[model samples]
Target: MITKTFKSESTIQTLQLVQQELGADAIVVSMREVPAGPIWNPWKKSAVEVVAVSPNDEPQVRKPQPPMQMPPSLEVAEEIPEIEWDIPAKKKTAKLPPPIKLNLNPLSGQPAPVTETVRMTEPTAPSNDRYSPPALKKIQQQLTQQGVESSLIERLMELSAETLSPSTLADVEASKRSIVQLMGAELRVQKGAGAFVSNNVVAVVGASGSGKTSVIAKLALFFRQGLHKSVTWVCADTVRTGAIAEAKAYTSALGLDLKLVYTPQDLKEVFNGEQANDLFLVDTPGYNPCNEKQMIELGALISEMPSRCTYLVAPATTKEADLHQLSASLGVFNIDGLIITKLDETYTFGGIYNFARKSNTPLAYFTSGRETSRNLETADPMRLVSALFGKEWNK
Candidate 1:
């Protein structure tokens, strides 16, 4: 038969090509899928390859020709002598023992339940300590060293276990991408830039030196310029040095108003003078979470505006232990979301990620540098996962 090969993006197309060239009588010999592009590129699309043969050239089977009788002289040349039979007797076969029988009747003369037998035969669930592939173990170690909590790392590894394979793991880039996708699934991000809105006073609170003011200034600029909303700055931090002057500098530049409130009663007056279509950005003094008096006063101030969006701003450099402590102490504010700042000042981001995940807080924004104009960004799941995996956030 005349043999030929045909290739196409699908099996149907390949079969059509084979039929067109070899006619309707063509026979398919074999078919398989192969990479359409270079083999090294795993993302390349696959093509179907088919081997076919034309029926017109199929080989014919010949009927066995009658065996020509051997010539009489050739057949008679080999004369042989007769031999005597000497056979032995057959050995006896061995038999197996009979099967044993058990009594199903109980001493009480009651019928046995069928469920007991099924329960005894049912299989058990697999152990939690499953065999982790070397690739997954390596990734777990990487996450651990990057300051991720053991619980969170274990969870991420468990979720990623199914996606790993010997071949896929060999490609380092592919493994990392898988990790990004896995961790991205766990990350929580705020939906939009609605943190600052009219009728809700936006407040920021955290431990001292957590870059609360920087975040506030960046947010003011964002709402004023980016969202094109009128921003009125409120500096509740009357005790901090240059707090008023700092608020003045930003407000004067943006041509917005600023208010200084030392007490919740004073804050109430500002609330009474609220204007239409105006965003209120309140900057509270750095709180000492352990200081019961300070926490109480912070809570009191937050209580003034029953409808407020309070963000707990924390530096990315904070340790996991301290993050938990802050969450416990400052949880009384009824925090609406989180704003992570000073991202450029630290290398490890696992602590924050674990904190947010465990506490179920939605990350609202990320601030890297001191530049109030360009450093603020809306929180993103991919960016957080990239940071966790040692990849550049921008990349």
Candidate 2:
């Protein structure tokens, strides 16, 4: 029997080649898959290597050779005693396995061809979404666990996948970079952190426990100490207990004044009495944002102070659906932008990013912890993107 090795781009091609080389009597003994070229070209893939042998024209006779017989006398075997046969004295030899084969080509570090049961596909260009970068699966799982909505997650994946060039898909790192850049570019970022400062009064409102009060303190103290501006704290949160004392303590500790107001007219008078350049950081008591009456009431109270900018304070760990509702409900208040809180508490900030993108509201400020006035800072797209990904990402 004569044996030959054949290689082609696909299973059908390999079989055709076998038929061409050894004619109709050719029998495939082995087959395997290998990479197309150096660097694993995704455009060209799934080459098959087949080992085939030719069938004999006729069966050949196998004559059994008689076993060697030793002479009866010991003296006759003295000359042959020098030879050693230390192998097990079995009557028959065990069939030897195929010789060790190793293919060490630089492009493909694989073992030599051998028999295989699996079929190989033809050479085909990278198709379908399966060949997407490794980062796609990683980001999908990360966002899914972070409580991002399935629709938003799917949209993000689809958008990023569309941006992936053939070259970008080949390198996962590049794919990750491209996606981050694309998201950041499409994002709505407002650089005017000081825009609200320019106005006389800044009214902060949000759901109860949304960190509205803490953000108020941070903004008031940050402006007073950092920018050396005169800031007055106002408490419109008459409902929640200790809410008055919380605003008073923060203001008094910094030698600033705090005002308490119950009605919209009361807040209107306080702003009316304040100096022209004084920064008024008004903190509103948090309430269930889903309550239409509560939101309308809050909006009316904020509408009292003229030249005021309203901000919807929210936490980063909030659910995506809630974030959307928060954006929509706060729209009644004529919200100028958003202030994201609790950065250090959770790793995910994608909900906020998506919220800002969907709401078309700029992220004015964000904080890491409840530091009196220290942890707060202006928003940066790169930093926010990095926080969302839970890793370093290029903008």
Candidate 3:
């Protein structure tokens, strides 16, 4: 038998070549397509290789010959004995035996035996070791040491190291800046006319214990002290205990006018009667988000008020889930912007990013420490980004 292998881009061409070389009866034993070179090369596409085998000419067998008798009277009968006839006789061809046939059926009590041997090897578990630098592992270990859960640490490490790898510490800072830029792009608000109003009539509304009183006082102080604008405090929080007196005292301390409002109707009546000159800082009652009545009343009050509704989101030491729920619950108020407080607490301030992303709420101001209005600053995206990534900001 003869065997041949041919490789070509076209299977039909390869078969034709094989048939041309070895007769048309050539049988195809095996065929496959395999990559030959790099994928970048246009001519390196996978091609088919065919392996073929053909039968060769069979060998002939000799036939057996009978023993030859001696030439009878060859030397006496002939005039002169032929020299060729005196020579020994050659043997005749003998017939070959029939070829043996193989039986392939197992039911016929004739089958080929197969043997298999398997060597037992130790089982190996999949490796969980990640291909990362020692610095990343150290950072993960540090976070774990600081009581951070393993799952969150793993996520943080993945976001920091794998997604944002830095060649040097400086590059790490640059990467952080880029992430902050992306975050800022998400949080950026449309640039409007100056201050929404020359004398801004801002109303701070939120749930109870959301630092509404403190935020009101801070805004009043910020306008009076920082911007030197005349500020008026409207004490609309008549529900909470001592809320009225607290607002009065804070307004008195800053030497600002304080008015009492029992309902949204009364707030509108008073505002319409009085002339609008200075900033009217309306302080609303701290309504529970879960209470439907309070939300309805607050919504009515906001709809009536002449000032812009700025929802105070005082997220301090709060979980991300709670913040998300709060943001969703208060979304009915149609809050214009956010005012985040209690920034000094909690290193993992992922809630800020969550709120900015999920709520699509732009930040207006942020208060860190409880210093009345000392640590309060206009919430700029670049500054917040720098703080979250621990990047130094240029003063």
Pick by lDDT: which candidate is best?
1
**Model 1 TM-score?**
0.64
Q: Each candidate's lDDT (Cα)?
A: 0.74, 0.69, 0.62
- Residue 88 in candidate 2 has what lDDT? 60
lDDT of 3 by residue, 1-395 (tens): 77778876655445545555544445565556656677788777766776666654521222222222347766423121111222335755433222212121112233222121223457999998777656656554544443433565566556666566456323544544544565566675524312443335678877677787788888788877766677778888888899888887887788998889887788877666455556788888887778888888888888876446565555655666767777777776667777877777656555565566567776777777666848777777767655554432223
TM value for model 2: 0.61
User: Which stretches in model 1 have alpha-carbon errors above 4 Å?
Assistant: 1-134, 194-199, 393-395
Tens-digit lDDT string for candidate 1 (1-395):
68888988765456556555665555565555667988788799978877766767653332222322456667534212122333446745433222112112222333221111111235788887788767777878888888877886787677666667777776656777888887777767665654545345789999989988888889888887777777888899888889788888877876878999999999989988666768888999888878989888888888888888888998889997898899999877778789998788777888888888888878889888877778788888778868876775444
Model 3 regions more than 4 Å off: 1-130, 133-166, 169-184, 189-199, 226-228, 274-276, 386-395
Better of 1 and 3 by lDDT: 1
**TM-scores for candidates 1 onward, in order:** 0.64, 0.61, 0.57
The clash count for each model shown is 0, 0, 5
**By summed lDDT, which 10 consecutive residues of candidate 1 come out lowest?**
111-120
Ranking by TM-score: 1, 2, 3
Q: What's the distance in Å from true for residue 240, model 2?
A: 0.7
In candidate 3 the C-alpha lDDT for residue 49 amounts to 73
